[model samples]
Target: MSKYGLGSPLKVVKKPGETLTLSCRGSGSSFGCCSMHWIRQQAGKPLVWMGCVNSDSSGNDYSESFKSRTEIIRDNSKSMVYLKLSGLTAEDSAVYYCARNSL
Candidate 1:
């Protein structure tokens, strides 16, 4: 394991257009990780790649549906990452996962 896990383990519920935040944190890596990746997996379905933020440059990339509605906030010193999502819909009902290079 990468010593990674969510800050919260509860199921999230939100209305349309609401904001949702999922916090992720971890320690140092030996694989020379440079990015943090987010994924969503709906019930009974496969995972969907949402995006990733390059830790080196603080730059980000997002999937089409999340292009303008998602943001990554990181506190490198604390090894913490926050996934902020907005403009929600029922389709957003899924499990979110945060991962980094398992060095």
Candidate 2:
């Protein structure tokens, strides 16, 4: 079990050329002080670090492969983080995860 509980949908379906938005809601006192990371793992494949956004909305960074197609947003007031991916394709399918980390 995790000290800070994070909630997200079990699955999402989208078609090619469509956009997808995934939400991650976290609960804990320290949630607002940490950065949120979005990662994905395909079947039998290694985890891929997609991107991250600061809780304070100070900044964000994305992996080279996802830089142009992904966006991460954090809303501390709602204790939620979001991952938006555009120009989707079959190759974008994967199991996504959201993790919190202290600065």
Model 1: lDDT to the true structure: 0.78
Give the lowest summed-lDDT range of ten residues in model 2. Answer: 1-10
Q: Rate the local accuracy (lDDT) of all candidates.
A: 0.78, 0.84
Give the per-residue Cα lDDT of candidate 2 at 56.
Answer: 91
* Clashing pairs in model 2, backbone N/Cα/C closer than 3 A: none
Best by lDDT: 2
What TM-score quantifies how close candidate 1 is to the native fold? 0.84
Evaluated at residue 20, the lDDT of candidate 1 is 96
lDDT of 2 at 73: 92
Can you write out model 1's per-residue Cα lDDT over 10-88, one digit (the tens) per residue? 7877989899998887665522255778888899999888888887635888999788999987777777788999999
lDDT of 2: 0.84
